[model samples]
Target chain A: MEGRERKTLVLGVIGADVHAVGNRILDYAFTQAGFKVVNIGVMASQEEFIQAAIETSAAAILVSSLYGHGEMDCRGMREKCQEAGIGDILLYVGGNLVVGKQDFGPVEKLFRKMGFDRVYPPGTMPEEPIADLRRDLGLA
Target chain B: MELSVKQMDPEEFGRQRQEVLTAWPTGKEVDFDEAVAYQKELPAAKVMAAKLAQGKAKGVTYAQPRAGVALISEHIELLRYLQDEGGADLLPTTIDSYTRQNRYKEAQGGIEESRSIGRSMLNGFPAVNHGVMACRRVVESVGVPVQVRHGTPDARLLAEVTLAGGFTDFEGGSISYNIPYAKDVPVENTIKYWQYVDRLVGLYEENGVRINREPFGPLTGTLVPPSISHAVGVIEAVLAVAQGVKSLSLGYGQCGNLIQDVAALHTLPLLAQEYLKKLGYPEVMITTVFHQWMGGFPQDEAKAYGVISWGAVAAALGKATKVIVKTPHEALGIPTKEANAAGLRTTKQVLNMLRDQTLPQTEELTLEEKMILRETRLILDKVLELGEGDMAVGSVRAFQAGVIDVPFAPSRFNVGKILPARDTTGAVRILDFGCLPFDREIRDFHQERIARRGRDEGRDPSFQMVIDDIYAIGKGMLVGRPRG
Candidate 1:
């Protein structure tokens, strides 16, 4: 994990959601923006993300969920990571994080309450998060 | 011409007479020649000779059509234009708008338009054109040679009957083209459906013709068990045609409703390319569209799908022979006539500009794109290593359920291992916006999914799709159902 100025990020779509178009775009965009992204593809689980993060010694974990079931599925994932001994790693999630119509304030609060460091609505460009990660890790 | 010249030699005659006698015990040789002669107003002997010659001609000539695109009736004009303008390079790109809803009147318009323009290589007729007359008109009309799709009952029966009657080039099968609507097929039924395709392929080959199976439907959802099985079955049937199946209608993008992860979408195109190639299919028509199943984001978000531009990248990298563009306007409904025209125009424009891109120059990537590319390569490798005795590809669902298992997982990388980044600055740059609110409605939208699955339905659907839920909630749209 050394000598590489670029940070390693674990990215994927979680659970039964098999959406790949956006995931691929994110992969391209992140790589274009100078991040090493390990895209786990579709139908991923919390364990998969944790394992990749741990294995890659990733700078952060970025989860994308397009299916409306993200809230139900992504809940407690941060705790799960803490149990896996990588609690301090940054957690960034975007895309449809819940099912049905709801408010963003409570939604972002909920993800934060669940321990996500940063949350984005669907269509959040990767550049914004990468820039934040750069500043947070003091790479900038 | 003497009667003796038309007649068989005595020994041959005796052999035929005795064989006929034994085959039908007590059957008398009724003077059928007299009846035929009366009908034709010819001598009995001449009539016999003519009947004998007609029977002889029954099984003599046989030729098969080559692999190419099957245009839907609606896209015929645009296809013809693509052809006439020396766009032969685009022939493998299939036309999709001509669904089962339209009639022959619409079909004729495409047919006539193609004829008027003098480019007949574009293949496809209406899904409902099931009779011999319609088939014959289509086959002969766009005579530069093309494959046809038949979905109506008459089309299936006509394809069967006509091929039996010596029109060997006709294609048949309803289930193959209707792949998108079949997500919930019982795994068993799916298996049977594919087995049936083998029989259909054999029938055509018996008539001395080969068929290019249309295994993917663009607007349809995932390529589930049935379609996957048919794809493999088509390969086995290639032997009937005295050659291996060399072309496949794979990578037809559907709504991607079953696809919640990049793994699934990556699976379709990669599998379509490598598996088909491994199974000996040489040509593949890959469709990369931003259809509804891609988790419809608001237009702005959807545009970032990068599928349109990157799809070209993947197709080129995957070595796809053809790529079909889903008109950006398709998520609304059947594209308007203007939209359809614009779609074709965009496809042409993009393909023209990308004709010489020759990207993926270095299949090997720096650490930046390494993990993603490696994950994709590993998946493709696992898909290819599948052997005859192994569980079939159609059983991907079961495969995921641990009914069977592939050797690798998506996260199989070393920890603390940072992959190197390459090509830091590319012309096509992605501009990122800092974190923003979910626009109250989008958040409330996601809450409903939680309430329904979490509180109401008692189903603990994962929250991995928060983005989709938030987006759908904000838009006040739930694709499959109305949220309670």
Candidate 2:
């Protein structure tokens, strides 16, 4: 494939969360990493993510939530994508996914149940994922 | 080719029953300047002068030198960097000593330090909101425009704080459980504050001081619909009181949640379209966070949130006048200088790139893209209205009552809710209602038309339409002049 034609990634913060600093950084880093990234930014709803993915023919939808209520805010995001007919589109979520102190084991289970393809803990950096992505997509 | 001209059409005769409204440059600003003077003198000047004199006598300075140095130095560096690199500078304002131990004070100080550090990283940028008197002191001592902020018991105190800060440019108190409700600085305080500000302008007129008003507080963070609406209303009200007030500053405070809402993003554009039409492209400041609950997320998650989409929206679409960027380490407690700097650096990098990139806009929008934006805006508006209604009854109560505890809103539109609907019988039930707007329909039509035109031109649809319609619509409206 030519260098000009690379798959795009649609990324954002879910629900009513307004944390933006991390989102900005990821947009820059991803661009540097050579991914055509379409960043929807914070407080983006599931529909916004799905639609952006469709419009861009994106390879994945990366959802970042920092307010502990991610579990609450991000619940069913995966299912919504599937219903939108992009069920094959990969969904990745990270950050503190639940409010206060919640059990990680159960939270992971809950997210998996909700439909996320992959889930990371509060501090999962983007570099590792991009590396994994390269390997998974045979880019490496 | 000669242009076809409709020459000598018959001129309509006599008895014309039409009223023609022509642009009458009433030199309104001149009259406004005088009114500004009168209002400033009446109450604003006296109250501010007395309060500022008192604060100066009391003299609040940086409390912890080590911590203060760390914080202040970060600010200085950030300001210097941005100035040197981006050529984007800010008002000069720095804190002396800040509160120790208390979470709220410490939080406020930390935000200030980060802000200052970022400011310093830029060249030719000055600090703002140093303190009421402190700001004045800096302006007097340094001979640069200084930012001054005040928090008082009431509207009268707001006036006093403004005066004490040696500023006609000022922001209101914290938007938390206490300060905004304090009997002295009640929600009605803007009324009082502006009344006094009006009088102060009058005083300035007599004395010949060129000062404008800068109003800031978290209108978006209110978890209520009218929070921002009310904040705008108050600004307009104050402007009415002080006719010559040149500028106004308003923003959401610590509102990571609101920024996350697709609906809230649209509000800035609407505000720019409406209230700020006359300002000729005023910078609208907005605040967004990265960490969980504004902090406490792991580094990777935090970085993603900070750098990826969240930051992109804030800079590209939000068209923020000034953004108060939060660090990931906030949840862990006060950020070390390194951590704070890293966050600022990341933000700076995003801003730099966005400037170079093409973003989405509505006017030159694709049908699908425009549909998404309009639907998102509509959903968010409805949700915010509900949230606002709940806020009117008290947001804290609403939160407790579970009205806004979860993100789910009932499905009433076909585009559907951003939050997920319940899953029953292994089938995910989605809420769908509402028709698309005319603007969105028009956009979609043009997108299809462009695609067809591309086919005729032997070019790819996406190729010919390289320009981002959604961004053009969003940011264009945000920074564009409105049609009469």
Candidate 3:
């Protein structure tokens, strides 16, 4: 194990969303891969993630929403993070993020335009995000 | 205080019913005596418990569809179409999302909006807002026995109002509804809430009305191992039976593997009975309801039919008492009534073609069945142990301890430790067991199966398989193979 403290990650299901299974898996995967995960749980506001990130010096904030109301709930999250002084925090959002069966390309593009570092389609596993966190946080 | 697995006193339940009834004016319309008498006069065909018994006796699987609308008239029209056209043997009045959240005001607004717009607005019927008489109208209009299907953590009022409104069957349980559908609701609160629900049903049973209680079986439905769902369903059954509810239709979601799905359907009622007997409620009537694939569906209607047929075959062969049908428009969101009817017809057609045919028992089927029984017992045993031999207390503590976790459940109360993925054969196997109380041999079996899949795929068995399997059905595949 590395002597230095594990890089911190703040994660939660943003908005009135409570989809927990994948959020927990991400927590397990990241922690198993040696990261300090700050799980804010569900119904989390953007400020909560940013606040946790600031408190823990988190390198990334993983946001999940499964209730299909994510777009409305996730609005101006980047702006909120910016105002919270954690603008550069690696932000990832995923899970049935929209209300209907739209193309994932457009959905991902939409979230990207909103300033998310990465956007994943629903049914995404932890491997991709874990790898992304490793590479993005310069652990590799 | 922790709710022990015990029956609620009748007067206490009556008092609780008063508060629940007064939550809405419609609730006030529920006269338990009249409701019980109304249910007593209903024909055998109009009662879900009786229909479930009939299906069990005939050794056939009935088809049920999830459907609801904002307006009461439209809701009845939809049920009539499904009954006359779809040939569904069972019916469900799906409660609206607003009702599931106990937001009756918003549900009332949606109903008003639907009335004005000349179209259904809300996702489902807000039975709570519509109250008892309206629910009775829906029930009276339907030929088949109707069940109230909803994802509600606290269904106390909904249960009282619907049961008193003349519905003969109810769906949901503390764990089944809460862990998968909610995020922050405490499991302890839900368990206590549903205790009132089960006790209410028991109250009806005491009044000579038989209401079939089915615990929603497809938790997080995204690759849940049969054992996890089985354990929860069995726990809920034990709790319901303890409260004196007699008839139950414990359900399981089709996991796509015929052997495994059939195995799940076979083992669920058995597991429920096994636990109920062990827990001192030995004589409860138990039936199995197999849910059609609860995962992602193909956008193409024909491909979706292929899935529906596969599920039908599983249900028919598995000999599930009824199969919850999914529509061709699943990927596109809430389906039209026509699409809903079509899905039911598709399942009925497949079921008819396979009448009296059963999946011949094989060594593999037997082995899968045995593994499920064993794995489920391990979890349930740990739950009892954690609760000091009480299921109600154990259920809350089990979730707290990560001993009975539902995979992908959004409940903060659920410790999300288990990660499930399809093994080489497409049956779900645990990649990360989390805090599941499986013994070493059970753990080895899962590991070996996953390891074999990894070796066959020329890749390490990782969470990548979970992602692949999730999108596989949508892409016309069952196993998510890596792209060449």
Candidate 4:
């Protein structure tokens, strides 16, 4: 356990958001926290995520959307992943996922319905997702 | 990539307009004849060029705030608040991201979602998706002129819809919009796209409509030097005028140094006029806008107010026609309407107090102006030389050769070789000149400035200093000094 292989996670800003800063920060944080992070960078479509997940055999797919169109962008992503033969892979999303300030409860529930295992609001620190990933993946 | 700087032929433009109008449902609502009629009836006060000219003639600096919400009603209400309660002299309709990327369908969805939720789901007004009628309502709701401020590389359709909808001013240039806002968009494509936009403005002018065109002055808004942004602004202005755009507004983002900021503003209009006249477009009306510090802002509302006030003072003393106001919640995410109004109020108060006080013609100010002029001339001259007297061709080649480079841009087309850092006085100076066509004297000046700052800080001039300066303001400091 002391020298166990790190869990691989695919991370990116989904849809057309080219928010490089947050993506870079997350890449650094996950690497520092001993996870294998394959940051696909920004403006990634759902197909790109599936391809990367298959290529890296990633344990989780962390999709980030900052430009408030996450609901539309994330819709059907789970079904797409299942069709791509990676249905069991973990899915997480965070950021200013929606435009306007809707209650986080409903937002989280909506993402869960879309098959995301975890949802984070804007300004969510990297550690929160990392800790949750450890428990969910039994890496703890 | 074979871009033309010539005025678009009427027949060609008309054919293109047909395709452009059919891009989205809202586009279909823009009837050129009706739009022209609507624009003719708009009062002089709602005409941006008229307001800017009035401000310039009277030596007054007008205040404008960036604000837009999803719903048309809410957006109009927000702008009204900025105009009435905040005392904003001009208003803006910031288009949402989806619309900026020409994804009108998603923007339409955002508008409907915002309406159902009773909150703005989109970050900005989807003016294109809302079409000519909704935009006209927005323009009519506010007493002041409303400018279309969005970062769209291919804004041809947007320009057509917005100008037809009664927006008197349009912001963004090919270089500014592409280098700063896009990752893989080619410079030539955006330039060609913007030519269509400018040609549309020209057509409106021919039909007796006077629309103001502005090239976003702050390229990356990091530590952009005066010369780089100036060259881009002048180039865009020349391009616009070539397409028959009559009224042009060139802008400069505030650097913290008082003398440098003042000098940048002072020389922008003068240089633009000289270049425009030299380029055989002497009749073009030019105006200058000073954007209140476009970089990182302090999270503390009070400190942010201080920064905003200093920007206002610069704009006033520099005699810029207008200043884009920044809110106190800049360090946070998108600001609330109240915060936006607060910022405009702060800027208006400062502008009023310093209206009569002129920036003194001190030796430092003169030297700064001279230095900026010299650097700007060198870059622009090389660009012209590269184009072989054709700016459209030269701009693409200039960027390809890295003769004109924007620091910290993510665009694959951008060279991203230049590195900028603050001088001893917190004036942004080039640390690495990249491949900019500057002579040895200009290089020596920037080297000496950085060396002096490094000597005082007991460290060498390096990328670390540039990194520190990037995060300095957010950390409550102008120059990011190393912690003791």
Candidate 5:
């Protein structure tokens, strides 16, 4: 998995959230799952995510927000990527996106509308995202 | 401008309220006349101060859970479930992050998005964006008194809207909200903002409407020494009292050690009352809240419940006025509504069982209480001296000079010089006092405690110990030990 020309993916906890537990967990999981993980750590901004994506030539940007501000924090991330000449980059986000209990369908749709290619719900397992990335990137 | 802990003039407050109300379109919905009338008509059960006083007088502890969603209707339903199903004695409307940052336009967008999708898209109830009438719906829907529990540094507008919407309690203070939550916000600015919030509460007091105010107690909620948090709590209480607030509740986060947690709960009220009386607010009604563990929780649900039950026991034996409950799913991120309700039920069971019991006063308990009291006095006294008798000015200066430091806080304004680690018995003690003005006796006590743990663990006290302790509980251990 290490030297086999593995696909690269950028991951981080966006905005001002410092919930590093999940970020670290995801990093370990993705690395173990054979993706070349470029972990940006917590408290990452939009520009940082795009810059990392460009630098790593990553296939996707997986954003996690655990402090319940994902909706506000991830508002223009896709547009930011587009502005930086990476409009085709796959964007994924998950965790508690909003403050209250809402159906996951609309939340997924909202992120999709925000230009995210894939949106996961809170409590989603790592396997789901890893598998989805494999199919989305045509690496299966 | 240098801000002093002083009451805002009524006319000045009114002028500010005008500006605050116009910060968002929802501001126009707040009419003081109508709000007061609405509040006067609320049932006694829905009044925060009345409920707290009742619990205090009866020696019973109320239970509250943190919960909120983006949609108002869903938020109302969630509170109802917590009240009727979870048996919560009080309710909380945890605001979304957008509202906490005063990003009302984003919150408005969240509300619209939630409505379109028939789901909540924000992490909390956007009371400011929901406007006063929408907030009123939440108040009317819940059977118990509701408090606005949020981490907003500048909560002036939030207070105006929520109180006008009939929220009877508000949580957070300049220091509590800033040090742990923000990275660049200055202490002086938040202190000035909160003065406006308190003056608004005072205005309600003048009109015979009682709202309970709580200073966020668990600064960083890591291995913070009891004295550091206690000092902040007492100072916030003093600051609130000066702003015409009549009902105040000082809080402490559960630190996992029974004796130290009990001692903190015991001494916090005594110290707050002492400070309030000395500051000429002898009539202010004081209460206590015990927050469940605020640090990293174990990932296993069963282990998490063990943590929750321990916090419940502490809150009960400590005789807190109310206990903030935590869910077993805490380690897994935002808890489902059922999980939130489960925590409330667990807490309620503990409180009911311990109603007729009390922790027997022991010699060790007495020593811990005295130690906490002595350490708290040293920090608070230095803060007062730094401000030249002004708690607000002293608070900013104290943080600047590292006299009062919270471990693991994110604020750049914080000195971040203090380090804390659990002693042999798992009681948090200062590993490094930084520039705290503790006398030699207090410093020696902390040093000796850490030394004892160091001797037992066969290693010198260092940053590794702090690092180990942070992950210790999550690994099913109180003290992190070297791998065999």
Candidate 6:
């Protein structure tokens, strides 16, 4: 256990979102914090993320949506993961989760119900997810 | 390996020119000797290099607006409005998307549609499809010097058509245009194509036409670190000069921080001159252009004016040769003529007010300038080393290895590994310096600054800051500190 191989994480910007800067940061942050990050880059579909996760045997899928269409783009992502037979793969979603400055409490609750292991608001830093991944992956 | 980025032989370039000019109907008229003579007869004031030289000598920051429409007359009208009403000291004929993509048939279709409809169906002026005479019509209609501005991966024919038509200045280079504009266009291909473009400009120079070349300095424009843009701009300048370009205007987009924006303008010309001299092109006349905020704009028109004015201030005080003005309708989409003129007037007002006063070199500004010079030199050295002292080879290889990645460029050729977010003071800092070849001290400087901001915000350094910064201007802020 002390010398176990690095755990994998699948990351990308979901939907027709062409936001690459944030996705790049997540890749670097997770890679620096000691995870084998498979970055799918911008304009990713949910199926693409799950496919990468299943191929890499990733411990989690970190989803970023900056174009404010995350709510629609991310719905049924958990079911897709389950259908892809990686149902238990950890799911983390963040970035302007809903259009406008809608109340975060309900948005977080809604995503949690949709099977996200963690939900980060628009300004949630990457450090928080790195810490969450370490604990969730049993690295901590 | 396919090695490109070398200066093309004149005879070899001539062989290639036949195929390039045959790409469209208008290519028939792009004759070199004829074009060179036409350029020589243009009034000296209408020559961009000469005008930019005067601007540099006078310490004036000329305002230029982006414009073009599909119809020739309509495009001319737009430029005239921008010139007469907007107070634009320089003019641009921005090429349309189809032309930029080399879809001349489609551009032709767009031109016909725009003509029949009595409005431009195309996004910009399709100069290539319009041929030499049509381009000359626009040039003749405009009083000031005209520059051809376009984001084209393969601009060989466009350069031929426009230059033959009487454009005095041309914008964009391989690295500058390819990385930021096209998602999958290989830099090598573009480098080769732009080499042809520069060689055409060189041929004109050989015949005594002093056309001005500008390396699009603001790659991706959104939160790009100055070191990265400077490295690309300086490299592009070298490549252009190798093909005999004598006049260059390197550009930089506003990065929100006054000291940093000014620092960038200061270092751009200084670094370009140093590299040109060191590379044996010591006499290349280098000028700088400051682009107004190229990020998300506040939808509120008043707030937008505030943003434009601040850019004007930076460009004026930093002593940029010209400032590319942005319209208030940035958030709303393509600006109307009135909105565009209003934006230009706003910028001109600020420039007029600040012309005499220099932002006294504050200690912070001095420090920033020193840091930019150091960082830019390191990247350029690595780039040259990568190409084995051949900048053309070096730039392509550097991008291949991610040694000079633009933050959010869509080009698959770009390794897309570097991450840029703002420090506490709103200056862009790298979050991920992977493969950049910066020394430990330089890396630590950026790390500590971002870490300091993280400490103040009660959060750790992460991508969240990048997101916040992306939306900051629209939200009426710059640093993007987390809300309580």
TM-score of each: 0.37, 0.36, 0.85, 0.90, 0.86, 0.80
Name the runs in model 5 displaced over 4 angstroms.
A1-13, A16-44, A48-64, A75-82, A85-140
> Could you give candidate 1's per-residue lDDT for residues B384-430 as a string of tens digits?
34422122332333323332211111211101111111011110000
Q: Is candidate 1 or candidate 2 better by DockQ?
A: 2
Put down candidate 5 lDDT per residue, B413-445, tens digits, no spaces.
Answer: 888788898899999999888999988898899
Q: Give RMSD to native, each candidate.
A: 21.9, 20.6, 4.7, 3.4, 4.9, 7.9
lDDT string, candidate 5, A4-96, tens digits: 689899998887575554665678778878888998866688999999999999989999987867877888887888899999999999986
**Model 6, C-alpha of B440: deviation from truth (Å):** 1.3
Off by over 4 Å in 4: A1-12, A19-41, A56-140
DockQ of each: 0.02, 0.03, 0.23, 0.29, 0.22, 0.07
Q: Stretches of candidate 1 above 4 Å error?
A: A1-140, B1-129, B143-180, B202-208, B217-244, B252-319, B361-484
DockQ of 3: 0.23
Question: For candidate 6, lDDT tens digit of each residue in A1-140?
Answer: 33789898899887645556566667877887888899987767798898899889988999997644576678899999888898998999997665333567998998999999999876566789998888888788
Scoring model 5 with DockQ, what do you get?
A: 0.22
Those runs of model 3 whose alpha carbons end farther than 4 Å from true positions after fitting are A1-140
What's each prediction's clash count? 56, 116, 2, 0, 9, 1
lDDT of 1 at B264: 31
How does candidate 3 score on lDDT?
0.85
- Any runs in candidate 6 off by more than 4 Å, and if so which? A1-140, B1-6
Which scores better on lDDT, 1 or 5?
Answer: 5
Which model, 1 or 3, shows the larger TM-score?
A: 3
lDDT scores for all predictions?
0.40, 0.39, 0.85, 0.87, 0.87, 0.86
Query: Interface RMSD of the predictions, in order shown?
Result: 13.7, 14.7, 4.0, 3.1, 4.2, 8.3
Model 4: residue B261 alpha-carbon error in angstroms? 1.3
Worst 10 residues of 3 chain B by lDDT: B1-10
lDDT of 6 by residue, B1-484 (tens): 2455566876778788999999888899878888888999999879999999999899889999988778888889999999999988999999876688787876787778667866565667889988999999888998899999988889999999999999999999999988877766788888889899998888888889999999998888788999999999999998999888999999999998999999999899889889988987748889999999988788778999999998999999898999999988765545678899999999999999999988788899998998899999999999899888889888888998888989887678888788788999999999999789898988888999999999999998877688778878878898888998
